[model samples]
Structure formats: structure tokens, C-alpha cells
Target: MSDTTAYSKKTMRVLLYLQQGELTEHQIYSFLASRVKDEQNSSVLRRIAGEELGHAKIWQKLTEKEVKTNRIKFWFYSLMALILGYTFVLKKMEKGEDKATKAYRSLITEVPQAKQISEDEDRHEQQLLAMLDEERLQYVGSMVLGLSDALVELSGTLAGLTFALQNTRLIALSGLITGISATLSMASSEYLSAKNSGDKNAVKSSMYTGIAYLFTVTFMVLPYLLLESYAVALGIMLVVVIIIIMFFTYYTSVAKDLPFGKRFFEMALISLSVAAISFVIGILVKRFLGIDI
Candidate 1:
């Protein structure tokens, strides 16, 4: 029997879709392998790329149709790898394969090779996980410490100052002074903590923490600097705080394979709760002292 005659139209379409997906993944892996600096990582990518091509060929034989690689997805993943690091982009691609694996399992009765293909997909994820070794991921803890502290501390400080001083310029000035001092202190603390723990990358880890903290501080204080109204600036700053938490939490979650919703909500709650308490204290202090600026 001919290849097309062996299956229904629906099955043929599914095979074609799987073939195209595998081809696209092959292209993406090949491109990443060429660009990766680490020899071991490049070797693993090349092996995976070859396996993907083989899988595509298997599907092609069954579908009896030549599938084209998805250029858009190929370039998108390439760009992401360049900007976000190879490990992150590769992990994201693996996540896409997870859905494909389920589809493959469903086709096991229609195609005997489907079970093997699904197993291969599962193996690819394991291989990628074992081989990935990105420096940024290594310093994620430091970044988290710096980012979380800055968000909570600066958000609260700015909220209090906004209510107490009721002046954008004074708030901005005070926030910057507070942020800078805190950045230095946090960096030094990270440095000492890493050193005590005998971490070889102590200096780099501390730098990552400090940079993350300073970056958060800058965004939080930007609205106050640009706007004249303290209340409006505080509102914008709170929005910025939420955004920073959302973004950083997502990055860490994706890179580390952790739960996104849990971490995001937890961090948001802590930061906003501190800001709310500080806002009330600012009002009480201002009213009690009868101070007006």
C-alpha cells in the first residue's frame, strides 16, 4: 500500500504537522550549535539537531511529503537565544516539544514509530537539562536577593516619602539617596555571604546582586523625577514595581523550571504589603508632627 493510502486525511495532516515541527527544531538547534561558544554544549546541540532531522525524515516517509522548516520560528528562537542565553531558549523549545510528545503518544496505534518518537522527545528534554550550564542562571540567587530587596525597600520608602513630603523633587532626591546607600550595603553583604560560603564566583555574584538592585531602584524613582505630582508618581512607581516583579519572576521561573504563579504572587504580596504599611505610617507621622513641606 502507498504511504498516503495507509492513513486517513486527518492522520496525514497530523504527520505533516509533526514533520514540520521536527524540521523547524532541527534548524533551530543547528543554528544554535553553530553560534554556541562552549564546545560541549555545541556538541550536544549538534547531536540533538541530527536526531530532530532523523525524526522529521521518519515522519516524511509516513506522510510522503517534504516539509519546510518554519523560518519565522527558527529566527525567533535564534534571536531569543542571542538575547536571553542558549539555555533559556533551548528550555523554551523543549516546552514546545512537550505538547508534541503528547500528540505522538496519541498516534501510537496509528503509527508504530510514534511511541519511539515520543520517547526520543522525552530524552531530548533530559539531555538538554543535564547539559545546560549558563553563568546567568548560576547567579540567579544573587539577582533575586538584590531585585527582591530593592523592590520591597524602595517601594516602601518612596510610598512613605510621597505621603510625608508630598513633593516629587524631595521624594526623588530622598529615594535616590536611599537607593544608592542600600545598593552598596546589599552588594557588600552579598560579597561577604558568598565569601563565607566559599563560593569561587563571590565577586561576580555580588556584582550581579548590586546591579539588579540598582536597576530596580532606577525604574522605581524615574516617575518621581519626571513628574511633579507626588501621588501620581507614587502610583506610577507602584506599577513599575509590579512590572519588575512580574518580569524578573518570569525569567527566573522559566530558566530554573520553577512555578511562576506562586513566586510572582508571593513577591508581589510582600512588596505591596510593605508599601501599604509604610504609606499609613507616613501619614500618621506627618499628622502627629504637624510637618508640612
Candidate 2:
């Protein structure tokens, strides 16, 4: 009754690899379950963790191999859940699972149970993950509002300042002052808007928006602070802007089931376009005003 002759050596190797991955994911889900505060959410996580273990056991029976969980990935994902919110981590993990799906497809025809497990892994698990209630996700709109405005507005400001002031230190100082004032203004506006809309979490939403805006401002201005050359700082800041766009786009794409490439390109295009236009305006202003500062 052993599966020794059921699969070839190569097939067994693939199954064993999947076995370890499933076990590792199971541990990750279990750890995440322990960290979640909501009892219903915890129950859902535990249910998924049990299913992941069940999938690992299926692979074990097919391969007749004992697998150890990857402790490093376990800890890494656990940390990600804590820092990035469990919904974000799970969405990221689901993307990673796409690679494993190919491996699972290989066993579907060969192993009868593979079909059900594959379906569960691809469809059921994802649906359940989508159902998980995470507070941060609910406030994603506020974060997006803050982050996007900061990126476009501040990137344009820095681009103009770089050309106009032509001094890294001066630009950094000006950008920080501008960014701080804008952050406060943005937070207040969000609070008022949310409150007018009858949102009970108005303060929390504003906090998320302000925090996101401030974080973006800090990154966008960092190059100016570190570098002495205005041109070099501007170039590095542009690169930082693109990176921030990519990271946020990917996060939203996965968590919200949106298209990554389209969102990324659109945001990049708009932000850079604003910067380009502002740069031109800065040149014009500098020439006309004849400011030496």
C-alpha cells in the first residue's frame, strides 16, 4: 500500500518539495493565527492553517518523505504579518503560491487527491483570505489618498526646487518644511471630510493618511539631505518616487484584486509628468526672477 512505485523519482522529488512548502506555510498560518486579535479571524486563520497541513500530509503520503518546515520563511512571513498587516501578507503569499500551483498541476493527473487539494489551494484558500477582516485594509483609501498626493505634489515641489534653488541643503530644508505643513493640512482635511461623511473612525482614518503622507515625504526628501549635488539628489529622489509608486501599486493590486502593471504605469507617468512640468516652470521662474538663492 506504499506509494513507492506510484511515482517516478523525479515526481517524488517534486512532491517532496511541495510537502515542505505546504508545511512551512502551515506553520506560518498557525503563527499568524496566534497573533490575530479577533476571535473569528483567528478561527479562520487556524482553519486555513489546518488545511495547509492537510495538503502537506497528502504530499507526504504520495512521496513517503518526512519534511521539515522552513523555519526562516516561517519567521519571515510572521514578521511580515505583524508589520504589513495580515491581509497584505496573505495577499503577498497568495502571489507566491502561483509558482507552487504549477507544481501542483503536475501531480493532478497522476494523483487523484491532487485535484481537490489544488482546487482548495487555488480557489478556497484565496476566497477565505479575501474574507479576512483587517482594519488597515479598510483604511487603505485614506493611505492611498495621502501617499498619492504626497508623491505627486512633493515630487513636483522637489523637482522645481532642485532647478530653482540649485542647492541640495536648501532644497532639503525647504522640502521638509513644505512637507510637514502639507501633512498637517492633509490630515485635517481628511478628518473633516470623514467626519462630514458620518464615519466614526474619522480620527483614525486621518491618522493613517497623515502617517502615510509623512512617510512618503521622508523618503522623497532623503536624497537631498544626504547628497551635496542638487542634480544628483534630484535624480535619486525621482528614482525613490518610482520605487514608492511600485511598492504601493503592488500592495494595492494584490490586496484589492486590481491590475498591477496598469496602476504602476499610470502612477509613474502622472508623477513624473508633474515633476517634468514643474522642472520646466522652475527653470522659467529662475531665469525671469534672476534669484541667486
Q: In candidate 1, which residue ranges exceed 4 Å CA deviation?
A: none
Model 1, range 1-293, lDDT digits (tens) per residue? Answer: 78679787777878998999989989998998898788888888898888889889989988888978899999999998898888888777776666677678668888987987788667765776678677788999999999999999999999999999999999999999999999999999999999999998899999999999999999999999999988899999999999999998888777889999989999999999999999999999999999999
* Full-model lDDT, candidate 2: 0.90
Top lDDT hit: 2
TM-score of each: 0.92, 0.95
Give candidate 1's error at residue 11 in angstroms: 1.6
Model 2 misplacement above 4 A: none
Top TM-score prediction, candidate number: 2
The number of clashing residue pairs in each candidate reads: 0, 0
TM-score for predicted model 1 compared with the true structure = 0.92
TM-score of 2: 0.95
Enumerate residue pairs that collide in model 1.
none
Which pairs of residues have clashing backbones in candidate 2? none
